[model samples]
Target chain A: MTPHDLKQQAQQQLAQQASLDWLSLPQKAQATFAALDMPTRKTEAWKYTPLTALLNTPYFAHTAAGQVDESAAADRLGQLGDVSRLVFVNGHLHPGLSSYSDLENQGIVTLFSNANDAQRELINAELGTAFEPQQHVFATLNYSCIEDGVLIQAPTDFKVQQPIQLVYLSSGEAQPALAQSRVLVYGAAGSSLELIEQYDSLGETNVFHNQMTEISLQPNARLTHLRLQVEHESLSQVNGLHVKLAAGSHYEQHALAFGSALKRNDININFNGSNAYCRLNGVFLSKHKQHIDNHLNLEHGVPHCNSDTVYKGFITDSSRAVFNGRIHIHKHAQKTEAHLNNKNLLLSKQAELDTKPELEIYADDVKCSHGASIGKLDDKSLFYFQSRGIDRATAEAMLCLGFVNEMVEQFPNTAVIELARQRLAEFFNDVDQLNHLWTLE
Target chain B: MSKTPLLEVKDLVAEVDGKTILNGISLTVNPGEVHAIMGPNGSGKSTLANVLAGRDDYEVVSGSVRFKGQDLFELEPEERAREGVFLAFQYPVEIPGVSNMQFLKASVDAVRKHRGQEELDAPSFMKLAREHCKELKLKPEFLKRGVNEGFSGGEKKRNEILQMALLEPSLALLDETDSGLDIDALQVAAEGVNALRNPERSFIVVTHYQRLLNYIVPDYVHVLAGGKIVKSGGRELALELEEKGYSWIQ
Candidate 1:
């Protein structure tokens, strides 16, 4: 994979760009893009998730279309209703199909293309700074070729009334498409905001989605972010979400991954200020040959900070899921409270889950614990349920759901919890063994 | 489902962890009959109940348990449950994440399926569950909580009865249901048990004292000591044993 060949591939992919934004990237960006093509298992960050399946297919950068079917996009998004909605098609913002107030005038929401000189300078200073581009080839690739994304900011002393949702829908009707998106949110002191990002592909076409979202919070600010990746099973997606919390700030994230043939999500958070807090929860349901990997890293850099993480996975058929969560506390970060937990349910003998929850603490004053468990359903509980007159199959289902519901029920947002539950039900419906195990009574 | 002997245990021998517990215990119960097995601590009364319930902890070495004219040991625990064998655990295990309502629904559905009936929907199931809870004097809010999580001893006992009432097992085995109950709770639980009695159902109440037997009087009383039935008599045996203690049975 020479740089010349990579450059030619990029040129061919961007040939039909309807907008000039695709060509506006600086020369350095092009050089960086050409340096990295498709990350392989050799890439440390992408060790568990191989990108060869995606690279095997030729994927072209998606171009601005004449008009996308708004109803189709709505139908997919509405599957989990009660979410504040924003629609994006082909890596371009579609404000008409989007449902949300224009907060640009209030200085709360600003498109990356619409940012002024000052905002651009701020983004340039902070963007791609929290992550090491050289180490993460996907991040480097996304940063270099990203055409447009969303930038949201909540000023100090401001509290948003509604949750901000960004829905990204990929439409590649004719060709194998690649859609790249980025999101940056900065919350000021004493501010709070709920943000949601959803990813879905409209067509059953072979496509690739690369996305990066970053969040930074100041002292006393609170932010809850929900991310859902339910793209078409034919698509391959690699997503990165980076969050930095200042002193006394709070940040919470919940993710649900249910689609894509090969999907990987990388999440990193740093507690830079004293008394900062972070909560990360996720659920991954995979079936057939789908491959999903989630890598999470949380750094307790300051004192008196607390972070809790729980990730659950249900794998069926020949599907595989990998979860790696690591927590680190600096010597100066005394009195930190952090806990990380991961559990997986294997419904088939061929299904697999590789999970690791690691903890590194320099400060002895911290209260940190990490637990990772991979086990079949508890036969005692199953027998107990069955002895009550429940059949064996239904008994198994109830116990399985109970195992995962421990964390799902903790979601503060009722709507998000319901959506996750609905997705769980849909997944269980297809799992024949689980379908035989139990149904909702 | 007849008014004859509901459960007939013959030369029942059970073991746990390679240690023999029940050494050739025998008992029989007729439909509409209540039998009380009173004994000292570790006298194998609870082991007998557990064996009847087909607990994996205890291995039945030699036994012919005839419940409603079927080979009880041949059935799985769930199958035995469908055959009307119920054991109210002395120490009910708390399932922290499973809601009580959901647990009850699963149990009821299993029983209904065993009876070749359709599963009840949410509304009907809730109605039946509520009615049973009321009969056991259990609070409706308890259904929303995890099964036995944070429940007091008496509450767990009442929940057991509630489950028994919902399932309506023919051979209900009360394993020390009166162990941790106060007088009021004991009265309520005994009353719940009394109300479930019918011509086609039978109960084997295992207790240490004669207090519970006073509330739900039994037709026959058996004194079990050293893993065997030492004496069998009318209900007066419970009072005589409570007065003289187990030294006489030993």
Candidate 2:
């Protein structure tokens, strides 16, 4: 089936749902989506990442919420202590399985249905304005089939003391399903928040998740975001994270993601005010016919703003990965300091990495640099390890994991780092050549 | 006691990129002996060490090597190391993100487990490693750093010696371990090696100059020219080479 037919089927399925307060949002977005066409091979953006598997999967129908093993989901993702966590099982919020009572009491974490009048008004205003609609057809397709989502709004100068976590766990039922989740975070002036988004397959099922996370920071507000997507060979996920930073606002994001049958992430950041800063660092691992595409765009609209990006990828065993990072500096954006770099390691005979690090500067006096490097594991290092009684398989695993652990160590929180390490150990061990090389904490 | 040589290499020929480096090299090492191999540039000194350590780039065209009455070339590199062969690299590789303590722990545990010995606890390993660090003039902080990361030339040599001491291999082939060290660091490295010398261990010290032999004196010296050992003599041969250079050897 073609993408247009899938979109038509999705719209029909969405129209048949019971009328709700937020139904107008998707109805308005369907018109917007209709104006855009699906990307084909001639489309420069989707040339390398083919969408055959996603289209082949019979996933237009929504799965009725089945029996979800709450405890098993919690066990797979161990405790990251004392944080406000919201658990979403099969596209709906699972309140009994979540522990955000304190945050709810603070009136910061609320469901969109239960949001107060003012908060609802803000959501209505800022839902779809995070990015230009034309350039991002797939990401913009999220609102057309929207369902229930969370609204996290911090009052002016009200800082969140602990990190807020949104866990999207899919209990892929026997039938194929389409799972959509959304989140809108507005950090008021002088407010701060640390948000963690974790996506995992709750069971062995066929599911396609279209997830969106949009964050807007007011003046002097701060946000630290972390994203993790553990490998699920049977899963297909597309995520768009749009962030807008006001004057004196700081935004930092660190992600450790993996590729599955198909995975794409479109991250767009707009600096609306001067003196806003952002630092993005992450690592993505792909193996065994998996495909991952990361497209990042940073726009420096104002002067005296700064942004830096460092993304590393480890591709092995016939997998494919694509990375495109662009930094755009406007004409009046003077003194804008932007640097973007991407480093990759191809550890197999057939693994592939296609990277393009670009910088477009319209200003005369801006400091910007971008570069990309793709390489293999050093042979001398491998020999050094083998000479020390470390087997070749273990040595290769160590080197590959070492390439990623360099970024893992830089993660800001210890609990998040622990979880990353645990998942990494498990992921690496699953590879055929990587065996018995884990030293977990 | 058995009289078999600790290591026996006969008619060993090896090459890299189709260029033969070790041409018909023959040697024998008995227990409790240090054999120094002195050669000028392009004389296959390091090739011998690499082949003995089972590096992949060097192809052994034809050779017969036996260690403790077992065929050496039949085992993989790690298997060779586990079977009591150790090579102190002339240029140690600096591995980032893996701490020196972790690297040593993994190596030590692998060797110990292969020998049917119990793995040491973290505290126990730390104590053992710290003592070796002090002896090699390395601060305890070096243990927490990445392996050879940002270390000076002399420090990398000391780290190699520290590893040799911990692994305690029966056959140690040191390839120019004293190349870039200062006199003081050379002396410290030599002392560290001498401390690991035992009755059952054998050493093959390969170098270009005789400066290191002054500290860790060898029992025998061999001069290699064009991938073949042309002359063999006692300790005084090193002195003669040091005084007159390879011109005197020919």
Query: Could you say which candidate leads in TM-score?
Result: 1
Q: Candidate 2, after superposition: displacement of residue A404 in Å?
A: 3.5
**Span of 10 residues, lowest total lDDT, candidate 2 chain B:** B96-105
* Top-scoring candidate (DockQ): 1
Each model's lDDT comes to 0.79, 0.86
> Which fraction of the native contacts appears in each prediction?
0.49, 0.62
DockQ of each: 0.55, 0.50
Total clashing pairs in model 1: 8
Q: How well is candidate 2 docked (DockQ)?
A: 0.50
Report the lDDT tens digits of candidate 1 across residue range A332-430.
Answer: 999999999998888889988888898998998989999998888876676566567666776776767776666566667777666666656666666
- Candidate 2 matches the true fold with a TM-score of 0.87
Candidate 2 lDDT by residue in tens digits, A230-297: 74666787888899999999999999998888888999999999999999998999988999999999
User: Which candidate comes out best when scored by lDDT?
Assistant: 2
Weakest ten-residue segment in model 2 chain A by summed lDDT: A432-441
Per residue, candidate 2 scores C-alpha lDDT tens digits across B54-154 of 99999999979999889999999999998889999999999876778878888888889999999999899999999999988899999877778899999
Q: Which residues of candidate 1, in runs, are more than 4 Å off?
A: A1-38, A60-68, A79-83, A102-105, A170-172, A436-441, B1-3, B40-42, B93-98, B116-121, B149-153, B179-187, B208-214, B234-236, B239-248
